[model samples]
Target: MCKALSLLANSQNLFVNLARVAIFIVMIWIGGLKAFQYEADGIVPFVANSPFFSYFYKYEAPEYKNYKNPEGKVVAKNIEWNKLNHTYIFSYALGVVICLIGILTLLGIWFPKIGLVGGLLTAGMAIVTLSFLITTPEVYVPNLGGDGPTPNFGFPYLSGAGRLVIKDVIMFSAGLICASNCASRILSCCACKAK
Candidate 1:
């Protein structure tokens, strides 16, 4: 048992590499989805309400609500509105950036310098995503009036969107870990050179 424990304890570098791979997988998958119509449409709520991103859209917050295109369902008018809003254009650009970050993070396994940038960028992206919890009303469950007022709605009550946004906390930490690991490697190399 102690032997196994020792092995595990000494495998921190392997684990960190694995984490980098995991981050790459997640970033690439999610970023690629941004190129799709449904995926682009899904982000409307977040982008429309975000002060950092709202300028990319021609319409306002509630205004986007009216033009929503449910996944897999095509609404011509909504598509037109999205095009006018430059929704797809923004998403495509965002996707490319995300994919690049993922590639850099993966390369960090061998090249610490590249990895450092990727890790920092990953954390930055996570921060922006987490901000949706505050800026996007869709993050919380709305009190959809039924026969009676909804009991579990609003702050402290997370809708699907809110749940997703909250998960970015994990990504934020992972990015920091990767960044720190790379920084350590870089410093060690510098120290060895000085000797």
Candidate 2:
């Protein structure tokens, strides 16, 4: 039992570091993608469906709901502006924030205070992304991808993007772990110096 516990304790730091690196990689990659117009177009549903985020767009709700994808359905200038906002104003902004969070969290590996701040920001973003589960019905697609039956309401299923959003929960946990470990180590070091 003692040996087993010791082994688990030894592995704890490894898992924490993995989680940290995962957060860093995810943020940097996603943030980089946000810089592209195509990636901006891709996140439309998640942003438009979100009550908190929908207001960011100048267009009305129906415009977004009716907007089609990849079939030459560009109807008006408003749509173009909407896409621009998604790319320039919203997605890019979010991307930068996420990248910053990841960078800060990763920095915690060397600088405890900086890492704690980053951990807090990462945790905050995780909370925001997780909020999409409640606001974005698009997260759940109909069985058969929207052609199953008459009035087939999709529920109890997470769409691909939704699953991606769901992964933030893990990141949130990791942020807490990073912060906790850093704080503990800092306190321990300070205590040893005092003695």
Q: For this target, which candidate reaches the highest lDDT against the unseen true structure?
A: 1
lDDT agreement of model 2 with the native: 0.76
TM-score (all chains, Cα) for each model: 0.96, 0.80
Whole-model lDDT values for every prediction: 0.94, 0.76
CA lDDT for candidate 1: 0.94
Instruction: Give me the runs in candidate 1 sitting further than 4 Å from their true place.
Output: 146-150
Error of 2 at 114 (Å): 1.0
Return the TM-score for candidate 1, rounded to 2 decimals: 0.96
**1-195, model 2: which lDDT tens digit per residue?**
999999988998777777778889988999888876566666776777777778776664445655545433444663576665553578788788878988998888888888888888888878888888888777776556454446444565678777888888887888889888778778887999999
